[model samples]
Target: MGVQWSDAADGPIGGDLTAVLAYATPAGGAVLTPIAPIGLRDRDAGRLTFTTSLGFGRKLDRIRSNPAIALAYHDRAHGFGASSAYVLVQGRATIVERPDREYLETVVGPAAARFLGAPRRGPFWDRWLAAYYADRVPVHVDIERVVTWPDLRCAGDPVVDGEPLPAGPPASQAPPKKGAVPRVDVAKGARRLRGMSDLLLGYPGADGRPWVVPVGLRADDPRGYELSAAPGLLHPGARRAGLVGHRYNAQLVGLAMRQHTGWLEVADDGSARYAPHTDAGFAAPANKTLLLLTNGFLARRGLKQAQRARAAEAAT
Candidate 1:
């Protein structure tokens, strides 16, 4: 199904029923799951719901403590060239027990139809729905914020969008400009590299389908990064890694900083030969931190100005 970019409640998802839910693990990492949303859209409440077998996993237990979560809907191809759409919904979730019969009927039945690739359910669908509801429980996701990129092609560009054009004469190619300031020091912590904390890596799974994994850069070494989950968490054979993010934000930090390569090989021996320092990826960690600090400063100034304007209006 084709996806249209709009500000609707469900516009970002298009006809995609599957999503990757990321939630915090007890040890400060994250766990990603492939789940099917069972058509629970409370537009007014800004919530979406899905169901999974009650005893099938330990994700329910993780939800009880840390509510901060993110659900992503990514369609790598819409048959429109290499263009794609990605949406991230940072939200909170909870498991609801003893749901009403009507709610179950409204959600589960249609989800099964979509999963089975049937436009309309036949007579036997009722039995399938009954079997699905036997041990599953609903997980409510209240959306806090949603961010989407209509075209992800820009993620591969060497220079970030909105930056100045090449400065040299047309005949010769100009080298990409470096950040003005020195690299900002990253604090000591696991997966806490100031501006380069989280990144999305995409590669082809064994089935040849596009697979994305989220990872964090090591604070101590900019060249190295750690996967939030296990090495083969999503797909055991996913070895080539492509970092995906807004081109501008990505320019500020990453391992492949400025060089745009087709794919970086991830070693099966738990090692990786990242792009050399000449590439922006090596310098990205420091540059990213500086950019973040600059953005923060500007944001604070804007907030203060807004506050002052409010006070002035009240005085008048």
Candidate 2:
């Protein structure tokens, strides 16, 4: 009833549990923040476990009264109720501006920009965009053997099933013909040029280097995009046509380039990996590739990039 920690080889480690904990949410309320209980260590060959939520929020009562706090994952909450059964992990939590890269690599490892809430992820080509990583700050949450509430059930769908999403659509969506390709049609492909954040531009007079820009200049259809340089950053073939028709085709292309929004891959290590280019995604094994939902425009983006490169070179 109180706390149980260590267990044996087959059975879960328990009985060594130390303390009970109370969680503090970001916004602080009855809601949850999808708190993931991760056991990060200094090595790779160790047993690593974690839990991810669809989306949850937390309350910050302990942070207000007492900074020193730890708690088991909450099962339910109200004005006055039994503290949600959980393993209490009382550790120091603070954002560290100065981080040793080696230490970070050991504990948290690396994650896609999406996890850190960056503008874009993929193979970022712009110097300005790449520099954004310079000011990054890392969070450190010290570890203490908290609770192991395997019996405690969560309110939302916290089941750690085979795949993240549910099985699939109804059987009706299955392939109808024998030789027909079962299309993953969810991908609408090419995003419109409008509001397209021109991360970089290699137009004339910006020197050999591409012009740097924020998420400036929207894509004005496939024809071209505006630049953000003093003179402006415009793509060489910014004069393409039928952007309206090309949109659905280029949607996925834009996504793969956006790096920030590349396709998610369930890695062998059980962590999700993201690739900025289509080649990286395709090069993976079938099991890995099966996780990705590719749109037809991925190829088109590569072709388009090549054409633009040739056009830029000829003009030079």
Candidate 3:
């Protein structure tokens, strides 16, 4: 049976302007990325949806291979409702590669307007954003489990729905052997994340799907950044993981985010250290016009890249 959300859980799930989506990788690791789940498509059935550009073909391909994924609603800043609960939704995702124009206009358009304001409509603006607005793919998640913590900080015991919590981390292939040394400058990475209010770490859970939890910087080590979280949330071992720090103004304007992929080591004593292997991020323009322009540019480029990759795959 599918998970049913209580009113407490529903508020954050349907109201939050954005969510952190974690999808499994073939190697049993997960990629944590931020997504705007515009609104709940089906509240009673626990169906949530998000849209991505075709340019993110690689991520879509990953989902097609491993549908197990999770969504974490850990932020309440500038959202639709008031909630103290932090929600984590574990589910399977199905992709709709090319939604028709009617669906985009009737379904997605109104939902986006509710949070982001009305769409820009003009001869010049329409032409400029044709690809950006039109060439989107929607991914729907069928909820399997919903975990809710009474405190926004996720500090206390969580109430679970749907599937039961696993006894322990599931057995999986060993993480790739990489040098423990940090590849990116530790100080620079830490400095970049300093301004962000929400910092999260994502790793594989006992069910082999990724679990995302809020984390704080405990200290800086020569090897990596040491992080701390609520007790009993993390498994003790060395594994592949991802970290993201992000913040946004009301209505999701003026956004800044930083993401890192790395190796995480958790001590038996619950101490955790992350050694960053790669780093990448971007800050969205605060001006709405400029933001749309940037989105159009990125979307066009991504569409081309997706097409080229598809051609290559066909040839192979």
Candidate 3: stretches off by over 4 Å: 170-175
Candidate 1 achieves a global lDDT of 0.43
Clash pairs, candidate 3, are: none
Off by over 4 Å in 2: 1-31, 35-38, 42-88, 105-107, 110-136, 143-145, 154-316
Cα lDDT of model 3 by residue, 95-148, tens digit: 997687798888998888888788788997787777777778788888888899
Tens-digit lDDT track of model 2 for 1-316:
2112333210211111111123332212111112222332222211222221111101222233323333233222211123333322333344443655665445433332212222333553232233223223343334332333333332222222111222321111121223122122212222322322222211111111111112233222222222222221122221101011101111112221221211222222322211111111122112312212221123234434545765788999
Model 2 TM-score (2 dp): 0.25
* Cα displacement (Å) at residue 2, model 2: 19
Off by over 4 Å in 1: 1-9, 76-83, 117-132, 153-316
Superposed Cα deviation of residue 265, candidate 1 (Å):
16
What TM-score would every model get versus the actual structure?
0.44, 0.25, 0.95
Best by TM-score: 3
State each candidate's clash count: 7, 41, 0
Is candidate 1 or 3 superior in lDDT? 3
TM-score of structure candidate 3 = 0.95
lDDT of 1 by residue, 1-316 (tens): 1112234325445344455666654433344544555344566566667776544335666676776666666533211113255565655678775666676666665664554333323454433333234445788776655555454321322211121323321121122144211132212322232333234544333322223444444323443333343343233321333443222222223232222122233444534332211112333243644543443443445445645765788999
